[model samples]
Target: MGTRLVPSGRTATRLLQAAIGVVLVEGLLLQNPGVVVNALLSLGVTFLPPVLARDWEVRLDTRLTLYIAVAVFLHSVGMLGFYESVWWYDHLTHTLSATVVAGVGYATAKAFDEHSDAVHFPGSFLALYVLLFTLALGVFWEVLEFGARLLATAVGMDPILFQYGIDDTLLDLVFNTAGAVLVALFGSGALRPLVESLTTRFDRSFGER
Candidate 1:
C-alpha cells in the first residue's frame, strides 16, 4: 500500500475554507435561509484569527487557528442535514465547540491572573474555573437553541437552531464538560503562547491608560 500524505496546516485551512464556500453556494441554491446565514457567518469567523493577529497583535498559532476553523466548519456543515442524518455529529460539534470556549476562558483568565497583581489563581482553582466557564456558556447555548425553536414555531418558520430535547441537552453538556476537562488538563502547555500574547496585550492597554 502506498503511504498517505498529510496536508500541511495552511493547505488544510485553505481546503476547509473552500469547502465552506461550497456550502454557502449550496445553501443559496437550495434556498435555505438557515444554511445560508450559518455558512456566511462561519466563513466570516474563519478569517478572525488573521484579523486578530493583524489588527490586535494577538497572535494564534496554526493549531489554534485550525481548531477554531474545524469547529466552525463542522457546525456549518451540520446545518445541511448532518445533525439529523449523522448520529454523533451534534455531539462531536458540541465537544469541539466546548474546547474553543474552554480555551478562551482559560486563556483570558490566566492572562488576567498574570497581568494583575490583585488577581491570583492557583492551578487547581483555574482548572475548576475553566470548567464552570465552559458549562455556563453551554447553558446559554442551550437556552438560545430552545428560544430559537420556540420563536420559529410561533412564527411558522424554520428554526435556525435546533433543540433536540432534555436528553440531548444533557448529553451536550456532558460532552462539553469532557472537552473542558481535556483543555484543563493539557491545554495550559499548548496555550502558553496565547496566554503570553494576551498578557502582553493587556499590559500594553493598561499601560497606555
Candidate 2:
C-alpha cells in the first residue's frame, strides 16, 4: 500500500508543481503583480519538502510532500480571483494552510523535546502547544492581510491580500483550530519518524559545533 501510494503521491505532486508553473506564467503574461508574487512564493514552498529531504537526509513520506504541494498550489490558484469568485475557496485554503502551520509547530516541539534533555514536553502539553501555535499564526496572517489592504489603499492599488471582515477572520481562526486539533490528535504517529530524523541531525550539528 505504501509503495502504491508513493507513486501516486509523486505523480500528484508533479502535476501540482506544473500547475504552479502555469500559474506563474499566466501571472507574468497577465501583468498581475499580486498573482505573480503569490505564484513565486508558492513555488518556493512546494519545493521545500524535497529540499529538506535531500539536505537533512530525512525520509519524508510522499504524502507529506504532496500535502504541502497541494496547499501552496491551491493558494496560488486562489490568488487568480477565486477568493472573491468562489466563497468557500478562502476557507479551504485557510484550513489547508493551518494544517501546515500545525505540522511545523508539532515538529518543532517534538524536535526540541527530543533534542534537549532538560526540556521535556508531555503529550497533552504538546497538543496544547500545537493548538496555540496555530492560532497565533492564524492571527498573524489576518493581521498581515489587514496591513496589506491598508497599504494598498494608501497607495491606491488593489491589495494582494484581502481581509473580508470580522466574521471571516473569526471563521478562519476556527478552521485553524480545527486543523491544529487534528494534528495534535493524529499527527504524532505520522510525524514521529520525521521528528526523530530532525532531532538526530540537530544533535549531530550541535555536537560538531
Candidate 3:
C-alpha cells in the first residue's frame, strides 16, 4: 500500500501545481489583482506547511501535500467568481476545505500521539478532539477573513467582508462543523492508516503540547 501511494502521490502533486499555475495565468489575464492575491495566498497556504516541515524535520508526504493543493484549488475556483455565480459553489468549497482541515488535524493528532502518553485518551475523546479542532480552525478562518477586510479598508480597497452577509458566515461555520464530523465519523478510519504510514516513514513526529 505504501509503495503504491508514493508514485501516485507525486503525480497528484505535480498535477495540482500545474493546475494552479493555470489559475494564476487566468487571474493575471483578467487583470483582477484580487484573484491573483487570493490564488497566491491559496498556494502559500497549500504548500508552505510542507516547506516549513522540511526545515523543521517533520514528515509531510506528497499525498498529504496533494490534499492541501486540492483544498486550495477549490478556493482558486471560488476566487474566479464561482462562489457568486453558482448558488452552491461556496457551500462546496467550504465543506471541502473544512474536511481537509479535519484531515490535517487528524494527521497531526495521530502523528503526535502515543498510547502511552498521559494526555492520550480513548474512543469518543479523540473524536471530540478532532471536532473541536475543526471548529476552532473554522473560527480562526473567519477572523482572518475579517482581518483581511480591515486591512483592505485601511488600504482604501472596498471591504470584502459581509459580501454574503451574516448568513454566509454562519452557514460556513455550519458546513465546517458538518465536514469535520463527517470525517471524524467515517473518513478517519481509511485516512488514518495512510497518514500513520507517512509519519512513520519520515520518523519524526510532534510532541503533545
Candidate 4:
C-alpha cells in the first residue's frame, strides 16, 4: 500500500474548525467575547503555518509544532499585557525564545531518530546544543531589534520605541537560556516517546503501513 496523504485543504479546514470549537468553549465557560476572540485569533495564527506547510519536506511534526506555537503565542501575549507595553525588545525576546525552542526541539528529535543506531550523545550535550542555539538566536534578535530601531529613527519615528537597553537584552538572553535548558532536560525525554507513539498511531490509522 502507498503512503496515505492528508490534503492540505483538509488540514486547513480542520484547524479552522478546531479554532472555532475553542472559541465556542471559551464563550460557554467564560461568557467573555473578548477572551473567545483572543483565543480564536491566537489559535488561527498558531495553526496557520503547519496547515499551510502540511506537504512540506520539514520533518517537524505538525501537531507538536502547533501545540508549541500556541503555547508560545499565549505566553508572549501574556507578557505584553503584564508589561503594559509592547516594546520591541519584549517582542523580539519572546519570538526568539519561542522559535529557538521549537526549532531545536524539532532538530533534536530528527537527530535522535537518525542516530538511533549510533551511540546516543550524553543528555548534557543535547542540553548544551539547546542553550547555545537559543543564545545565538537571542543575539540575532537583538541585532534585528537594533536595526529596526535605527530604521525607525531614520524614518522620523520614535527611536525610543525600540530601544532595548543592554541590561534588558542580557536579562532576556539569560531567561531564554534557562528556558532552553529546561525544555532540553524535561521536554526531550517527555516529548520523544509521545511523538513516536503519535507518529506510529497516525501511520497505522491512515493505513500507511
Give the distance in Å from residue 166's predicted Cα in candidate 1 to where it truly belongs. 1.0
Candidate 1 similarity to native, TM-score: 0.92
Clashes per candidate (backbone, < 3 Å): 0, 0, 0, 0
Q: What is the lDDT of residue 140 in candidate 2?
A: 97
Candidate 3, residues 135-194, lDDT tens digits: the string is 899888888787877787799874443245578889999999988988888866657654
Q: Which 10-residue window of candidate 4 scores lowest in summed lDDT?
A: 1-10
Q: Where does the lowest 10-residue lDDT sum fall in candidate 1?
A: 1-10
User: lDDT tens digits, residues 81-160, model 1?
Assistant: 99999999999999999999999999999999999988899999999999999999999999999999899899987888
Per-residue lDDT of 1-209 in model 2, one digit per residue for the tens?
12123666878877998999999999889888788889999989877766776777655566776788889999999998999899889889988899889998898789888888878999999999999999999999999999998998999876778898899999999999988998998998777767877787778877522
Instruction: Estimate TM-scores for all models.
Output: 0.92, 0.90, 0.78, 0.54
How much lDDT does candidate 2 score?
0.85
The per-model lDDT (C-alpha) reads 0.88, 0.85, 0.71, 0.53
- Cα RMSDs of all predictions? 4.8, 2.8, 3.7, 9.5
**Considering every candidate listed, which one attains the maximal TM-score?**
1
Off by over 4 Å in 2: 1-7
lDDT string, candidate 4, 104-191, tens digits: 5545454554435443556677667667777777788677768867886687754322435788777677777666766775565445
